[model samples]
Target: MQKIMLTGATGLLGRTLYKTLVKDFEVVGTGFNRATPPLYQLDLGNQQAVIDFLEQHQPDALIHAAAERKPDVCENEPEQTIALNVAASEFLAKQCAQRDIALIFISTDYVFDGKTPPYLESAQANPLNLYGQSKQRAEQAVLAHSTRHSIIRVPVLYGDVSELAESAVSVIATQISATQTTAHDNWAVRYPTHVEDIAFTLRDLLKRPENLGGIFHISDNQAMSKYDMACIMADILGYPQSLLEPLDEPSQSAARPHDCALADSRLKQLGIAHGREFKEALKSILLTA
Candidate 1:
């Protein structure tokens, strides 16, 4: 079996990716501040520490899953955001290039301006916020470093969460549970994909290394805004929908795209896809949470 080194193993998406990838690959999981047993501690922001870890494991491929995904937080702390999201990525790409290790960098659909719908893999990136800008810069760095490197862009994701507030998707339930009067942004659209589907898609993609280069978009087709998600959660939790309000205009500290529907053109050609109905899946996750 091929060895794969995964970063951010203790995180939301990282945890799922680790569980999925380990079934077929010799997976080496790594984490930072929350590092625990079975998860090697390594700080991506520290270049030398990262270098040493890479040298120690020397996996066949590495998945850069650790990132600052919060737009508001990234806006508040640009230096910290860029250090982990951009600088660390560039450094990792360089190191991977030197070691001849295949790299799969997890990215976000926010790389686009959201003015355009259904962005293709070849689409030009014009980010609207610091978070998107950092990921976009990191994408450029990774691709520029080597042709063997791959970028997988996904949209809002939700899956088995440790807490209601852990995932942006599941956080709707937390908000609705706290107060039926919670307000949500109705302007910006999102596609809440299950993280397990992304993990499965990646697992399948790993079987064909020849198809692992350039950019690929992985997302569920169902589109809904925060308000839509909250309303659904309210219904799921038996809360009154009347109290939930929708803000028609931008309601976030950082500007977001209106709709960034990713066109899974590359993944489509490779005959690889995984998706599930929004409401049905949400019901199971919410019931468990």
Candidate 2:
């Protein structure tokens, strides 16, 4: 079996990726602060440590999934964001390129300005926040280093979480309650995708020889705002939807795109897709959580 090395194995999407990919390929997981016994403890920011880890494993493909994902946190800690998002990623790409290891970099759809509705893989990146800018830089570094690398951009993710607040989508459950009023953003459009679907997409993409080292978009087609999501969660959790209030203006401190609907044309052409109904899937997740 071809060995796969995955970073951020303890994270939301990385956890799912590890679980899904391990079924086919030999997956070696790594984490920094929360790493367990099986998952190697390696800091991506440490150049020598990362180099040593890569040389030790010599994986067929390395999925660089570790990143400072929160826009607010990234905005507050610009240095930390650049170190992890840009520098670490650039280092990994260079190391992977030298070793001839297929590197799959996990990226965010926030790379676009959201002026356009659906962005193709070839769309120019015009990030509006530090978080997006860092990822954009990383994307450029990866592509510059090797054609053997791939970048998979996904939107807001929701999935099996250790806690309710773990994912942006699942965290909506926290804001909702039966007796109290809650407010959510109705202005910014979001495509909340399941992490498992992204994992499955990567699994399928790895099997195909033609599209192994190119840009791909993986996201759910269902478009909804935070208020729309809150309404659905309220219904599922038996909370009154009437208590929910929609804010039709951008309220967050970080500048977010209005709508960045990723058009997965490449995946479509390759007949590679995996998705779930947002309502039903989220019901199962919320109930389980």
Candidate 3:
């Protein structure tokens, strides 16, 4: 079996990917601050530690999923963000290049400002926050260090393993199950991809290793606001629509991307089919959980 080194194995997406990838690959999942499958206490900010880990493992490929995801945290600590997102990625990419290994980096839709809807892979990136800036810099460093790299830019993702899972559709389901009235009235538009879809897509991309040199946008076919997404989740979980509360835009503290949808034409062209619709995906997660 091919050896795959996966970073951020304890994170929401990382856990899901680790579970999916373990079946087919010798997955060595590394955790920065948590424990999960193939767990390693490897902090990416420590260059020598990362180098030692990579040199010892000598995996066939590397999947960089670890990140400082919170925009507010990245904003507060820009230097830390740079260290983890940019410097670590650069080191990993250089190491992978030297070893002739493929590298897959996870990026976010936030790299593009909300002014443009449905950003393409070729679109110019103008990050509005420190988190996005860090990811953008990481992407650049990876591309600069290695040509055998794939950058996947995903939209708002929600599923069982996600940090926002409980607070997302799961929250509504739990509330409805407990007969508690809940309101989800936030008007921020985004294409929320399921974690399962992302995992599957990454696996597919891994199979065709030659397609490892460009950016690809992975997301659902349709777009919806947070309010709309909440309603959909409620309906899927058999919650009454009357219990749903829609909040105005002014209510949110973080600067949101009003229309951060992505066009998955490249993914389709690569013959990687989308897994499920947003609602169907949410229902699957709820049922499985």
Candidate 4:
């Protein structure tokens, strides 16, 4: 079995990926605080710690899922964001390169300014926030340091209870369940992807390391606004749509990209299978809960 090293194994995506990977490979998962199978407490920002960990484990592949995901938080701590997102990633990529291990970097759709619709892989990135900028810088560092690297850019993700409030759809679902009203009448547009699909896609990519290298956009095919997504969730949950209310976008504090939809044509063309529609994915998650 291939030995895999995964960072951020405690995170939403990281946890899901870890659970799935352990089923098929020899997986060593790492987190800053939490402990799980093959879990380590090493800080990636600590160069010596990272190097020592790599030297000790020496996994065949490295999947980096760790990052300060909150845009506002990143804005508040730019230095910390850069250290984890860019500097640490560079160190990992270099180490992986030296060992001829495949490096997989999880990136975000926020790298785009959301000026255009259905962003393609070839489009130029113009991040509007510190988080996006840091991720973009990290991607650049990974690419520059390692030729055998795959950068998978994911949009909004939802799955499992852990990702609920963190996910736009889950947040709306919980709000509608509580207040019986739509909270996001007017917010922003994005393509929501299921975490399971992301994990499966990563697994497949690892199997075909050569074909999956470089940047790839992974997201559901359909795009919808926050208001529409909320209404759909209410409908799926058998809640009355009257409870849904739309809010104006200008009323929000954080500057969100209005149309951050990603195009998954490349994924399809490459024969990468994706799972359920946004509504179906949300329904399955609620049922499993």
Candidate 5:
């Protein structure tokens, strides 16, 4: 079995992938703040720690799912964001290159400035926020430093949360479940891709690492505003739709893209199709959760 090491093991994507891929491969997952069985604590920002971990584990592949994702946090802590997102990414890519191990870097749709409708893998990155800039830099590092690497770009993600209000969808579900009225931002459009599908896609990508290398977009091919998502959530949970209200997009310190929907034509050509529609995926998650 291929020995695989995954970063951000305690994160939504990392934990999901670990649960799905553990039976198929020898998986070692790592997290910073939280450490559990099969997952050890490591500071990715510390080059020595990362190098030592990689040398010790000697995994055949590494899936980099760790990042400073919050826009406000990234904006406030630009240096820290660079430490984890760019420097750590470059170091990991270099180590993987020397070890001849396959590397998969998880990226984001925020790299685009939301000027275009449906972004492809080849689209030029024009990030609006520090978070997006950090991820885009990490993508470039993977491309420059790694010999065998794949960059997977994803959009707004939702899944079973370990904590309350982990994702926007979960927050919506929580708010609507308790209160009769809830307000949602109607401006920015998003593609609510499920974490399970991304995990499944990574599993499939592992089967053909060579073919899947380079940049690829994998998102549920549906575009809906946040208000629309709230409506769907309300409907799914049997909550009153009348309680949902559209509110203007709140002013933010960080600039976010208006629309970051992705099209995976390349993934389809490679026989890797996204699993389900947004609503169906959301329904499945709600039922299972």
Candidate 6:
């Protein structure tokens, strides 16, 4: 079996990918915090530590999901965000290139400034916020360091989580379950892709490393506002949809992309079909919860 090193194993997407990939690959997982038996604690901000970890493990491929993802926090702490998102990614890409290892960099839809409806893999990135700029720079670094790399850009994602706050989708479920007043963004639209779909897609991509390289946008084709998502969660979980308060384009310290939905026809063209629609995945998560 080929070996894989997965960073950010404690995160929503990282944890999901780690679990699914372990079924077929010898997975070495790491997280900054909440390190368990298999997942080691590694400070990705420290360049030498990341290099040392890669040298020691020597995995055939590295899936980098670690990043400072909070838009507000990233705007406030540009230095720290750059340290983790851009600098760390550059270091990883360089090391992977040296060893001829496959590198899969998890990116975000924020790279596009929401001006375009459906961004293709070939679309030029024009980030509006610090978080998007950081991720965009990191994507460029990966491309510069190696040709054998996959930069997968995803939109809002949620899946089965031990805690509701772990993801945006689950957070809505938690709020409605408690019958608490929740605010939803009605203006800003996003593609709510499940983490399971991303995990399955990543697994399929890794299986054909030779055929997969360069940038790819992977997300469900459906576009819905946050208010719409809240309503769906409320309808599915038997909670009153009235509990969700619709806000029209609320102000944010960090500028948000209005419509950052991604197009995943590239994955379809590559013969990898992802399972579960948004409604189906949301129902599964809430019902099981």
Candidate 6 lDDT, tens digit per residue, 42-71? 988777888889889999999999988889
- Runs in model 5 deviating more than 4 A are 177-180, 248-250, 287-289
Model 3, span 64-162: residue lDDT tens: 998888777787887888888888888888888988888999999988887878788999998877888889988998888777888999887777844
Q: For residue 274, what is the lDDT in candidate 3? A: 60
Q: Model 4 over residues 1-289: C-alpha lDDT tens digits?
A: 8899999988878889998988888999999977654687868878888888888988989999998888878878888888888888888888889888889999999999898877888888889888888899989988887677878899888888664676656776667763545467476677778888899988887777667568888887677777888778777777877877788664544466777777766778879987786777778877666
How do all models score by TM-score? 0.98, 0.99, 0.88, 0.91, 0.93, 0.94
Off by over 4 Å in 3: 162-185, 236-239, 287-289
lDDT of 2 by residue, 61-173 (tens): 99999999999999999999999999999999999999999999999999999998799999999999999999999999999999999999999999999998999999999
Name the regions of candidate 1 deviating beyond 4 angstroms: 177-180
Residues 165-271, candidate 1: write the lDDT tens digits.
88999988877754537788999999999999999998998878888889999999999999999888888878989989899999788999999999999888888
Best lDDT among the predictions, by candidate number:
2
Candidate 5 per-residue C-alpha lDDT over 1-289 given as tens digits, one digit per residue, 9 for 90 to 100: 8888999989888889899889788999999988777689998878888888888999988999998888899999999999998989989998899888888999999999998868888888999999999999889989887657989999888887785367766666766643567788887888888888999888888877667568889898677877898899888888888888887675568898998888787788888875677787678667666
Over 4 Å off, model 2? none
How well does candidate 1 score on lDDT at residue 254? 95
- Candidate 6: give its CA RMSD in angstroms: 1.7
Which one wins by lDDT: 1 or 4? 1
Residue 162 shift from truth in candidate 5, angstroms: 1.2
Clash counts for all predictions: 0, 0, 3, 7, 0, 0
Taking all chains together, the TM-score of candidate 6 against the true structure is 0.94
Error of 1 at 115 (Å): 0.8
Please give the RMSD to the true structure for each candidate, in Å: 1.1, 0.7, 2.6, 2.1, 1.8, 1.7
Q: For residue 144, what is the lDDT in candidate 1? A: 94
Q: If both were scored by TM-score, which would come out higher, candidate 2 or candidate 6?
A: 2
